[model samples]
Target: MSKMLTYDACVERIEQLREKMIVTAAQKGMHDPLVLQYSQELDRAHNYILFLQSLNIDNLSKT
Candidate 1:
Protein backbone atom coordinates (compact mmCIF):
# COMPACT_ATOMS: atom_id res chain seq x y z
CA MET A 1 0.00 0.00 0.00
CA SER A 2 1.08 3.57 -0.63
CA LYS A 3 1.82 5.75 2.36
CA MET A 4 0.50 9.26 2.77
CA LEU A 5 3.03 12.08 3.05
CA THR A 6 3.13 14.44 5.99
CA TYR A 7 2.88 18.18 5.36
CA ASP A 8 6.58 18.68 6.04
CA ALA A 9 7.52 15.87 3.67
CA CYS A 10 5.32 17.35 0.96
CA VAL A 11 6.91 20.76 1.41
CA GLU A 12 10.39 19.21 1.25
CA ARG A 13 9.48 17.39 -1.98
CA ILE A 14 8.23 20.63 -3.55
CA GLU A 15 11.46 22.37 -2.59
CA GLN A 16 13.53 19.55 -4.06
CA LEU A 17 11.54 19.59 -7.30
CA ARG A 18 11.83 23.37 -7.58
CA GLU A 19 15.61 23.18 -7.22
CA LYS A 20 15.92 20.39 -9.79
CA MET A 21 13.64 22.23 -12.21
CA ILE A 22 15.69 25.38 -11.85
CA VAL A 23 18.90 23.52 -12.60
CA THR A 24 17.35 21.65 -15.51
CA ALA A 25 15.95 24.83 -17.02
CA ALA A 26 19.33 26.52 -16.79
CA GLN A 27 21.12 23.63 -18.46
CA LYS A 28 18.50 22.59 -21.04
CA GLY A 29 16.60 25.86 -21.55
CA MET A 30 13.15 26.68 -20.22
CA HIS A 31 11.38 25.11 -23.19
CA ASP A 32 13.11 21.77 -22.94
CA PRO A 33 10.81 18.77 -22.55
CA LEU A 34 12.56 17.67 -19.36
CA VAL A 35 12.09 21.10 -17.86
CA LEU A 36 8.43 21.07 -18.82
CA GLN A 37 8.01 17.68 -17.21
CA TYR A 38 9.60 18.93 -14.01
CA SER A 39 7.36 21.98 -14.05
CA GLN A 40 4.26 19.80 -14.39
CA GLU A 41 5.43 17.64 -11.49
CA LEU A 42 6.00 20.74 -9.41
CA ASP A 43 2.53 22.01 -10.26
CA ARG A 44 0.99 18.76 -9.13
CA ALA A 45 2.90 18.95 -5.84
CA HIS A 46 1.64 22.46 -5.22
CA ASN A 47 -1.89 21.39 -6.09
CA TYR A 48 -1.68 18.50 -3.64
CA ILE A 49 -0.61 20.85 -0.87
CA LEU A 50 -3.50 23.15 -1.71
CA PHE A 51 -5.88 20.22 -1.63
CA LEU A 52 -4.59 19.21 1.81
CA GLN A 53 -5.05 22.75 3.06
CA SER A 54 -8.61 22.77 1.77
CA LEU A 55 -9.29 19.55 3.65
CA ASN A 56 -7.97 21.09 6.84
CA ILE A 57 -10.16 24.14 6.33
CA ASP A 58 -13.18 21.93 5.80
CA ASN A 59 -12.47 20.05 8.99
CA LEU A 60 -12.04 23.29 10.90
CA SER A 61 -15.39 24.54 9.64
CA LYS A 62 -17.07 21.39 10.90
CA THR A 63 -15.54 21.67 14.36
Candidate 2:
Protein backbone atom coordinates (compact mmCIF):
# COMPACT_ATOMS: atom_id res chain seq x y z
CA MET A 1 0.00 0.00 0.00
CA SER A 2 1.14 3.57 -0.64
CA LYS A 3 1.97 5.81 2.32
CA MET A 4 -0.07 8.94 2.97
CA LEU A 5 1.64 12.20 2.11
CA THR A 6 1.17 15.73 3.41
CA TYR A 7 -0.34 18.37 1.13
CA ASP A 8 3.02 19.94 0.40
CA ALA A 9 4.55 16.59 -0.41
CA CYS A 10 1.69 15.69 -2.72
CA VAL A 11 2.10 18.99 -4.55
CA GLU A 12 5.81 18.36 -4.94
CA ARG A 13 5.19 14.87 -6.29
CA ILE A 14 2.67 16.19 -8.79
CA GLU A 15 5.16 18.82 -9.93
CA GLN A 16 7.81 16.19 -10.48
CA LEU A 17 5.42 14.05 -12.52
CA ARG A 18 4.42 17.09 -14.56
CA GLU A 19 8.02 17.85 -15.36
CA LYS A 20 8.68 14.27 -16.43
CA MET A 21 5.64 14.25 -18.67
CA ILE A 22 6.70 17.54 -20.27
CA VAL A 23 10.13 16.20 -21.01
CA THR A 24 8.74 12.99 -22.44
CA ALA A 25 6.30 14.89 -24.59
CA ALA A 26 9.02 17.16 -25.89
CA GLN A 27 11.14 14.19 -26.85
CA LYS A 28 8.19 12.62 -28.67
CA GLY A 29 7.31 15.99 -30.31
CA MET A 30 4.69 18.14 -28.59
CA HIS A 31 2.47 18.06 -31.66
CA ASP A 32 1.02 14.70 -30.64
CA PRO A 33 -2.65 15.06 -29.72
CA LEU A 34 -2.54 12.70 -26.76
CA VAL A 35 0.50 14.44 -25.32
CA LEU A 36 -1.19 17.82 -25.52
CA GLN A 37 -4.35 16.50 -23.91
CA TYR A 38 -2.47 14.83 -21.08
CA SER A 39 -0.51 18.01 -20.41
CA GLN A 40 -3.67 20.08 -20.20
CA GLU A 41 -5.27 17.56 -17.84
CA LEU A 42 -2.23 17.58 -15.61
CA ASP A 43 -2.30 21.37 -15.46
CA ARG A 44 -5.95 21.32 -14.46
CA ALA A 45 -5.35 18.71 -11.80
CA HIS A 46 -2.44 20.66 -10.33
CA ASN A 47 -4.47 23.85 -10.22
CA TYR A 48 -7.37 22.09 -8.54
CA ILE A 49 -5.10 20.53 -5.95
CA LEU A 50 -3.53 23.90 -5.16
CA PHE A 51 -6.93 25.48 -4.85
CA LEU A 52 -7.99 22.81 -2.37
CA GLN A 53 -4.84 23.38 -0.36
CA SER A 54 -5.57 27.10 -0.21
CA LEU A 55 -9.08 26.41 1.03
CA ASN A 56 -7.72 24.21 3.77
CA ILE A 57 -5.41 26.97 4.89
CA ASP A 58 -8.23 29.47 4.89
CA ASN A 59 -10.37 27.19 7.03
CA LEU A 60 -7.54 26.73 9.52
CA SER A 61 -7.14 30.50 9.77
CA LYS A 62 -10.82 30.92 10.63
CA THR A 63 -10.59 28.48 13.55
Candidate 1 wrong stretches, greater than 4 Å = 1-3
Q: Taking the tens digit of each residue's C-alpha lDDT, what string does model 1 give over 1-63?
A: 034677788899899999999999999899999989889988988888888899999999999
Q: Which stretches in model 2 have alpha-carbon errors above 4 Å?
A: 1-20, 23-27
Candidate lDDT scores, in order, read 0.86, 0.72
Tens-place lDDT digits, model 2, residues 2-31: 455566766776787688678878788778
Worst 10 residues of 1 by lDDT: 1-10
Error of 1 at 30 (Å): 0.7
- Ten residues in sequence with the least summed lDDT for candidate 2: 1-10
